[model samples]
Each structure stands twice: as C-alpha cells, then as structure tokens.
Target: MIVGLTGGIGSGKTTVLNFFKAFQNISVYIADEEAKNLMNSSPLLKSQLINAFGKELFVDNTLQRAYLSNLVFKDPKKLQILNEIVHPQVAKHFSEFVALNAHKAYILYENAILFETQNNQFCDCILTVSAPLEDRISRIIHRDQTTRRAVLDRMQHQFPEEKKRLQSNYLIQNTSLPALKEEVYRIHNILTL
Candidate 1:
C-alpha cells in the first residue's frame, strides 16, 4: 500500500517518517527533498525554471534557494507557478520509486502539500500529522532561523490543519517524542496489516 504522509510546516512529519523507517517492511519517499534534488540535477527542470522565473534564479549552476524561497513565499502566484513546474516531474519520479520498492509491504510518500497538489488521489490512504499552531510556528522559527511572521506566511499557502485532518484516513498529533513514537508504532501495525 502507498501511504501518503503529510503535514504543514514544522508539524514533525519528518520525525514521524523516521519512526516509520525503523520498520523493515516500510519504504519511504520524501517528495519535497526529491523535488529539490530534481531542480538541481535535471536539465529540463533547470531550463523550465530559468525560462519562467529568470536565469538569475540559478547561479553558478546551483539554484539560488534563498532568493527563490523569499520570492515564492511572498507571492502566491509565483508559488503556484513554481509548483506547476516541479510537481509533475516529482510525481513521475514517485511512481518509479513505488515500482522499485514494490517488495515492501508499505511505501510512505511524504509531502507537506499532498492535499494541495491533489496527490492524495494517488494514495491508498493519508496520514496527516498536526501540532498546535503556536508550537508549529516556534518549531519553524528555531529550525529554519526564520521569524514567526515568515513561518506564518508559508503556512498560509497550505490547507488548514483541521481541513487536512478531516480528509485524512489517519491523524497523528505530534506533541512529544515518546508519545509520537508510540503513535507511529500503533499506526505502523495497522498499515502493515
């Protein structure tokens, strides 16, 4: 089964993914991380980005991530356009990943915007991780060294936690590591069965 693992910024999806990784039968695909890799390594993607955004977005054959992040997070249209450019390639890559991992009992495809991108339709089930808004803001501020305002701005682009939770097959409230590990194990057992 392909399980879509998703959450908003700073909601601890990565932590949950790590817990899932401990299971021998589970294979993981991190969409956002793979998108970053594709953006840098794929010539076709590089040309598309430069054509749409500008050549300056890529400096010395590397994407100017800070510049791109600042631009996209500040503008919804730009963010949408960027997603348009990257998501299809990621989806194709993800399909290949699933085929390669077909021997596994479960494949966890993790993305922050799984619902937003309509990728949930491709999933057998979705697990949405959530945390209190204040906790999420604090986590992003510390991890990314960005201000609360900046984190909030990024969060604005995602569907509300409540909406995601309502749509998901499973929900994990991530407040503490011990509790989270317990929850992950519980869910893992259910998914594997």
Candidate 2:
C-alpha cells in the first residue's frame, strides 16, 4: 500500500512521518526533502530554476532558499510558478521511489501538496495532520523565524486545514505529542493489516 501523508504548513507532518518511519514494514519518502536534494544535484533542475527565477538565486552552486522563500512567499503567482517547476519533478522521483520499495508492505509518500498536485491519486489512502490555526501560525513563526504576517502569507498558499481534513481518508490531530504518536501507530497498524 502507498499512503500519502500531508498537512498544511506547520501541521507537524514531519513528526508524524517519523512515527510512520519506525514501522519495520514501512518505507518513507519525503518529497520536499528529495526536491531540495535534487535542486542542487540535478543540472536540469538547476538550469530550469535559474531560467525561471534568475542566475543569482543560486550562489556557489547552492540554491539560496531563504532568499527564494522571501521572494515567492510574498507573491502567490511566483510561488505557484516555483511549485509548477518542482512538483512534477518530485512526482516523477516519487514514482521511482515507490517502484523501488514495492516489495515493502507499505510505503509512505509524504508531501505537503498531495491533494493539490493530485499525488494522492497514487496512494491507496491519504492521511492529513491538522492543528488549530493559532497553533499552526505560532509554530511556523517559531520554526521559520519569520513574522506572523509572513507566516500567514505562506499559510494562505496552502489548502485550508478544514478542507484538507475533509478530503483526507484519515486525520491526525497533533495537539499532544503522545496522542500524535498513538494516532500514527494506530494508523500504521490499520494500513499494514
């Protein structure tokens, strides 16, 4: 089985994903992290990014993520364009990863935009992690060290938590760490069985 795990910004997707990773029969693939790795390692992606944004976005062969985040987050269209470039490549990579891990009892495909990109179509089921709006905003502010306004701006680009929860096959509420871990383990058992 392929489980597509997703959440809005600061929804603790990584924390939940780590729990899923503990299962001996499950393999996890994180699209965002893989995309970051590819951005630097793949010459084709590098050229596309430089062409779409600019040469200066990469310094010393490294993608200047902070600068790009500042640029794209402020402009919705620019952020969409960036996603357009990265999401397809990430999707292709995900297919390969899943194929390679086909022998496993299940594989977790974790991507923030699973539904938006229709990546969930590849999964047997989809799980979304959710938190209160205030909690999510505060988490992003602390994690990204950005202003609350900036965090809200970024959140606006993501699918709303309530809507995503409705669309998901399963929802994990992440107010408490123990409860979150239990939710993950519970879901893992269901998926594996």
Candidate 3:
C-alpha cells in the first residue's frame, strides 16, 4: 500500500517521516527534495525557470533558491506557474520510485503539498501531521532562521489544519518525539493489518 504523508510547514512531518524510515520493508519518497534536485539538474526545468523568472534565478547552473522563494512568495500566480513546471516532473519521478518498490508491503510519498495538488487521491491512505499554529510558527522561526512574520506569511498559503485533518485517514500530533514515535508504530501496525 502507498501512503501519502503531508502537513503544513513546520508541522513536524519530517520527524515522523524519519520514524517511518526506521522500520523494515518501507520506502520513502520525499517530493520536495526530489523537486529541488530536478529543478537544479533537469535541462527542461532549468530553461523554463530561466524563461519564466530570469537568468539571475540561476547561479553556477543551480537554482538560486532564495531568489526563487522571494519571487513565488510575493506572487501567488508565479508560484502556481512554478508548480505547473515542477509538479509533473516530480510526479513522474514518484511513479518510477513506486514501481521500483512494487514488491514492498508499504511505501510513503511524503510531500508538503499533497492535499494542495490532490496527490492524496493516489494514496491508499493519507496521514496528516499537525501542531498548534503557535508551535509551528516557532519551529519554523528557529529552523529556518526567519522572522515570525515571514513564517506566518508562508503558513497562510497552506490549507488550514482543520481542513487537512478532515481529509486524512490518520492525524499525528507532534508535540513530543516519543509520543510521535509511538503513534507511528501504531499506524504501521494498523496499516500492516
């Protein structure tokens, strides 16, 4: 079975993903990391990004992430256009990854925008990690070394927690790592059953 794991920014999704990685016979595909690699390496993506943004968006043939982030965060339409260019490639990469692991009992497709892109529909089950807004903002501020306003601004772009929670088959509240690990094991058992 394929499970789609998702959460808003700073929602402790990565921590839970790590917990899953500890188990046997499970494969994890992280879409954001794959997308970043594709943006930097794919000739098609490179030319398209340069055309859509500008030459300055690349430095040493690699994407200038800060510049791209600023561009997309400032304009929602540009973000959509960027997603248009990248999501399909990421999806294709995911399909290949899934095929490679077809014999496994379980695989995870981890993405921050799983619900946003309706990719959750492809999963056998959906898991949404969540944390209180204040905690999430604090985590992002410390982890990204960004201002509260900036973190909150990014969070505003995500689907609300209540809405995402409603769409998920399981909700993992990540207030503490030990508790979260216990929840992960519980979910693993349930899925294997």
Candidate 4:
C-alpha cells in the first residue's frame, strides 16, 4: 500500500513520517526534500530554475533557498511558476521510489501538495495531518525564522485544511505526540493487515 502523506507548512508531516517509521514495515519518500536534491543535482532542473528564478539564485551548484523563497512568497504567480518547474520531476522520482519499494507492505510518500497536484492518483490511500491555523503559523514562524505574514503568504498558496480533511482517507489531528504516534501505529496495523 502506498499512503500519500501531506499537510500544510509546519503541520509536522515529517514528524509524523518519523512516527510511522517506528513500525519498520514501511519506506518513506519525502517529495519536498527530494525536490531540493533534484534542484541541485539535475542539470535540467538547474537550468529551468535558473531560467525561472534567475541564475544568481544558485551558488556552488546549490540553491540559495532564502533568496528564492523571498521572491516566490511575495508573489503567488512566482510560487506557482516554481511549482510548475519542479513538480513534474518530483512526481517522476516519486514513482520510481514507489517501484523500488514495491515489496514493502506499505510505503509513505510524503508531500505537502498531494491533493493540490493530484498526486493522490498514485496513492492507495491518503493521510492528511492538520493542526489549528494559529498553531501552524506559529510553528512555521519558529521553524523557518519568518514572520507571521510570510507564513500566511505561503499558506495562501496551499489548499485549505478543511478541504484536505474532507479529501483524506485518514486524518491525524496532531495536537500531541503520543496521540499522533498512537494513530500512526493504528494505521500501520490497519494497512499491514
């Protein structure tokens, strides 16, 4: 089973992936992290990013993430364009990851935009993690060292939690760690059985 794991920024999707990893019965493929790696490693992606964001955005074959983020967050159109440039590649790599892990009882393909990009088509089921909006904003502000407005700006480009909640086959409320772990384990048993 391939479970599409997703949540908004600061919603702790990665943390939830860790909890799922405890089962030792699944493999994880984090799309955003893979996209970053592709941005640095893939010549085609590097050229496209340079064309879209400017050549100065990369240094020593690595993306200057902060600089690129500033431009994209300021303009919704720019963010959409960047996503357009990267998502297809990420989706392609995600498919390969699934194929390699085909023997696993379950695999977790974690991406923040699973539903938005219609990547859910690749999933056997979808799990959406969520928390209160203020909590999400605060978490992102602390983790990204950005202002509330900036976090809100990025959130603006994402699908709303309520809508994701409706779409998910399973939902993790994510108010606390124990509950989150318990839910993950429960789902693991369900999937494995």
Candidate 5:
C-alpha cells in the first residue's frame, strides 16, 4: 500500500515519519530530501535549474540552497517553476523506490506538497498532518532560522490546511509528541492490518 504523508511546513511531518519508522512493516520515502539530493547530484537537473533561475544557483559546484529558498519563497511563479523542474525526477525516483519496497505492507511516501503537486493520485490513501497556524509559524521560524514573513510566504504557496483535511483519509492534529506517537501507532496498526 502506498500511503501518502503530507503536511504544511513546520507541521512536524518528520516527527510523525519517525514514529512510523518504528514499525518494521513500513518503508519510508521522503520526497523533499530526495529532491535536494537530485538537485545537487544530477548534472542534467543542474543545467535545467540554472536555465530557469540563474548561474548563481550553484556556488563551488554545490547548490546554493539559501539563495534558491529566498528566491522561490518570494515568488509564486518561481516556486512553481522550481517544482516543475524537480518533481518529475522525484516522481521517477519514487516509482523505483516503490518497486523495491513492494513487499512492505505499507510504503509511506512523505512529501510536503503531495496534494499541491497532485501526487495524491498515486497514493492508496492519504494522511495529512496539521497544527495551529501560530504553532506552525513558530516552529518554522525556529527550525529554518527564517522570519515570520518568509514562512507566511511559503505557506501561501501550499494547499490550504482546511482543504487538505477535508481531502485526506486520515488527519493527525499535531499538538504534543505523546499524542502524536499514539496516533501514529494507531494508524500504523490500522494500515498494516
């Protein structure tokens, strides 16, 4: 089963992913991390990004992540263009991952933009994690060392939390670690069974 896991920035999706990792029956794939790896490693992807953004996308042959983040967060078109450049490669890679993990009872594909990218179509079921807006803002500001304005800019590009909640098969309202873990375990049992 391909289980799509997604949430907005700073919603603790990574923490929930960790809890799911404790279950031996589940295999996990994190799309955003893989996208970064692809951007850094693939020469073809590198050229495409440079064409869309600029030569300064890389410095000393390494992706200038901070540069790209600042650029895309401020412009919706740039963000979409970046996604268009990266998502196809990630999707292809994810298909290979799914094939290798076909024996697993559940394949948890974690992506922040699953719904935004319409990747949910590939999922057997979708799980959306959510938190209060202020909590989310605070978490991202701390984790990314970014300002509230920047976080809000990125949030605007994502599908609305309310809409995601309505569409998802399961919802995790993340408020505390203990509660989050309990929910993850409960959902894991349900999926595996």
Candidate 6:
C-alpha cells in the first residue's frame, strides 16, 4: 500500500513522518527534498527555471533560491509556472522511487502540496496532520526562524485544513507529541491489520 502524508507548512507533518519512519518495511519519499535536489541538479529543470525566471535565478550553476523565491511568492502566476516546471520532474522521480520499493509492505510519500498537485490520487490512503493555526505559526517560527508573516504567506498557499481533513482517510491532530505518537501507532496497527 502507498500512503500520502500531507499537511500545510508548520503542521508537524515531519514529526508524523518521523513516527512513520520508526516502522520497519516502510520506505519514505520526501517529495520536497527530492524536488529541491532535482531543481539544483537537473539540466532540464535548470534550463526551464532560467527561461521562466531569467539567468539571474542561478548563481555558480546553482539555484539562486532567494531571488527565485521572492519572485515566485510575490506573484501567484510565477509560483504556478514554477510548480508546473518542477512538479512533473518530481512526480517522475517519485514514480521511480515507488518502483524501487514495490517489494515493501507499504511506502509513504510525504509532500506539503500533495492535495494541490493531486498526488494523493496515487496513494491508497491519505493522512493529514493538523494543528491549530496559532500553534502552527509558532512552530514554523521556531523551526525555520522565519517571521510570522512569512510563514503565514506560505501557509495561505496550501489547502485549508478543513478541506484537507475532508479528503483524508486519517486525521492526526499534532498538538502534543505523546498523543501524536499514540495516534500514529494506532494507525500503523490498523494499516498492518
């Protein structure tokens, strides 16, 4: 089985991922990390990004992330274009990763934009991690050392919790670590059964 684990930024999805990581026979594909690497390494992605955002978007043949981020996040159209260029490559890489782990009992695909990209369609089930907005913002601030407004800006781009919750097969409230672990183990038991 394949499960898609997702939540908005700062929703503690990574914490849930860590719990899932503890389980044996499970392979985890972290789409964001993979995409970041691809963006920096793939010649095709490099050419496309430069075409979309200009050569200044790269420095020393590496992604000028700060420049590109300010450009994309400031314009919804630019962000969409960027996603269009990168998500397909990321999806292709994910397919390969999935094939490599097909022998496993199950695999987990963790992505912040699972719903947005419709990647959840590829999963047997979807798990959405959720937390109160204030708590999420605080967590992002503490973890990323990003300003509240910047965190909120990124969060606003993701699907709302209500919508994601409605689509999810499992909803894990991430307000507390102990409770979160219990919830994860419960879900693991259910899946294994």
Index of the highest-lDDT prediction: 1
Worst 10 residues of 1 by lDDT: 184-193
Looking at candidate 2, the ten consecutive residues that score lowest on lDDT are 152-161
Model 5 C-alpha lDDT per residue in residues 54-89, reported as the tens digit of each score: 999999999999999989988888988998899999
lDDT of 6 by residue, 1-193 (tens): 8999999888899899999999997899999889889999999999999999999988999888778877887789999999999999998999999999998878889999899999989999999999999998998899877798888888878999999999999999997899999999999888878
Stretches off by above 4 angstroms in model 2 are none
Q: Measured by TM-score, how close is model 6 to the native structure?
A: 0.95
- What's the count of clashing pairs in each model shown? 0, 0, 0, 0, 0, 0
The TM-score of predicted model 2 comes to 0.96
- TM-score of each predicted structure versus truth: 0.97, 0.96, 0.98, 0.96, 0.97, 0.95
RMSD in order of candidates: 0.9, 1.1, 0.8, 1.1, 0.9, 1.2
Report the lDDT tens digits of candidate 4 across residue range 89-122: 9888987888898889888989898888888888
For candidate 4, the per-residue lDDT at 112 reads 92
What pairs collide in candidate 5? none
Off by more than 4 A, model 3: none
Taken over the whole model, the C-alpha lDDT of each candidate is 0.93, 0.88, 0.92, 0.89, 0.93, 0.91
- Shift in Å, residue 2, candidate 5: 0.4
Rank by lDDT, highest first.
Answer: 1, 5, 3, 6, 4, 2
Which digits, one per residue and each the tens of the lDDT, describe model 2 over residues 1-193? 8888999989899899888877888799998899999898889899999998999889999999998898898887888888888888888888898889999998888989888777878888999999888988899889888898988887777877888888889999999999999999888888877
Angstrom error of the Cα, residue 3, model 5: value is: 0.3
